[model samples]
Target: MSDKALDEEHEKYIKEHSALFANYAKAEFMIKHNYISKQDRLDMAEKQEIALNRVEKQEKRRERLMKQIIPRFVLYFAIMTLIYLFFRWLSMYT
Candidate 1:
């Protein structure tokens, strides 16, 4: 192919797939250079902060539910234990 025709073809290919080409080139460059940008570090920190907040909210909700459940459970167990002891005492007497 003539040089002019080859250049035109390459330009057309780049125009047609500009985004894909840019992404591929960026990935290749990052792999070769092993460098992370400040923006990437900031984004990672933001994501970690969001995740920590979500986990903390979940833990607070779990603790609230546990607080409600534990007393009910303890009350139920105490009543059951008292009933069992009363039954045993009556059986022994009779």
Candidate 2:
């Protein structure tokens, strides 16, 4: 085959099967390099999941606290406004 035709064939093969082969190659490289064992990777992934869940729960708690606090804040402001108006009326009479 001509060099140009061979290149075209290789490109076509990559387009068709690159994802599968790439996954295999990545796993192979990782195992061969011994940078991380499979069990260690799984443990890290599980710890990450737990950490993410804890963060999500804290966010939810903060949101709920804000929801409860906003209405109390509005009520406090309204009560203060009414007290100020009442004192102003008393001053006008004096």
Candidate 3:
């Protein structure tokens, strides 16, 4: 009930869950006050790091699939073209 007691309780809450409190505060400010804080910027940076990591993983997967597919397609096309030319020459001679 006393201001000092409330302050102590608030400090304890902050210490126990600093990251959660910081995120909640940022959300509250963005929603209610329509203002961004320093903590919000830090949170955005952290989220960007996660997003970049996800994008990097996706790109690696795309590269691996491309590596597998390109050679197979090239080989298939070359075989098909050779077969077509061989048939065309045989038909002309017959």
Candidate 4:
């Protein structure tokens, strides 16, 4: 296609999808920040729901990681303590 024709087509396409592009930008911004600022108002109900869900999902993932980390740390400490006690007792007998 010629440059002028291509330009016109591009402009038309953008005009048709302007709302879609705006929504995508908003969603991208929200995902990066993980929360909307007080100054930024979410006009659409769908956008609000998506933000709430993302925040909740992050919290759940954090809780899961904490649960896993605490148990592993306690198990490691317990094993090390047992090994130290065993060596001390063996040295005393010998």
Candidate 5:
């Protein structure tokens, strides 16, 4: 390829392949993806990524809240029952 003659021969070979290239079929060319540019694809990717992050953040917050907080009624009912039993035992025995 360094010599002029070799470069010319490779160029001729590449030209022959280009000459044989076929045009796209009408059905294939009409597909939506074929019409989307790189910037459109990137924009869609960014929107989807933001949505995914939002969902993930909400899920993690929900899980953390579930772990940290107890239902108030259950805790209060148990504590009141124990106090009532303890007082009843004191009244009966003392």
Candidate 6:
């Protein structure tokens, strides 16, 4: 194979196999270098299922308030204010 054809084949192989080998090289490098400490890993593991459940509950509660209650409140306020202004405008004209 010519050098250009070999380069194209290597590129094709890399593109085809990227998903199968995703982050493998980076993991290998990290294992050799050990960037994070064992203590930090233990700290991450301390946040177990209970903590995750609490966080998920809070997220759902916040989502409900944001998606339902707050928007309803704002819509009611805007609609009532507009209706009141329309009545006041009519009363003034009459």
Best by lDDT: 3
| Count of residue pairs whose backbone atoms collide, per candidate | 0, 0, 0, 0, 0, 0
RMSD value for candidate 1? 22.0
lDDT of 6: 0.64
Score candidate 1 by TM-score against the native. Answer: 0.45
Rank order by TM-score, top first? Answer: 2, 4, 5, 3, 1, 6
TM-scores for all candidates?
0.45, 0.56, 0.46, 0.53, 0.51, 0.39
The segments of candidate 3 whose C-alpha lies over 4 angstroms from its true place after superposition are 1-43
Q: Where does candidate 5 clash, by residue pair? A: none
RMSD of each: 22.0, 19.5, 19.4, 18.0, 25.2, 17.0
Cα lDDT tens digits, model 5, 1-94, are 1369657855865664453332123323434557756676676557656755765675687577656555655788899999999999999988
**lDDT per prediction?**
0.69, 0.71, 0.72, 0.71, 0.61, 0.64
Over 4 Å off in model 4, which ranges? 1-43
Instruction: Return whichever of 3 and 4 wins on TM-score.
Output: 4
The C-alpha local distance difference test score for the whole of candidate 1 amounts to 0.69
Ranked candidates, highest lDDT first: 3, 2, 4, 1, 6, 5
TM accuracy, model 3: 0.46
Which stretches of candidate 6 lie above 4 Å from their native place? 1-47
- Candidate 3 local lDDT, 3-89, one digit each (tens): 796678557555645665575567666757757777876787687567557656756875787698789999999999999999999
Instruction: Report how far off residue 87 is in candidate 4 (Å).
Output: 0.6
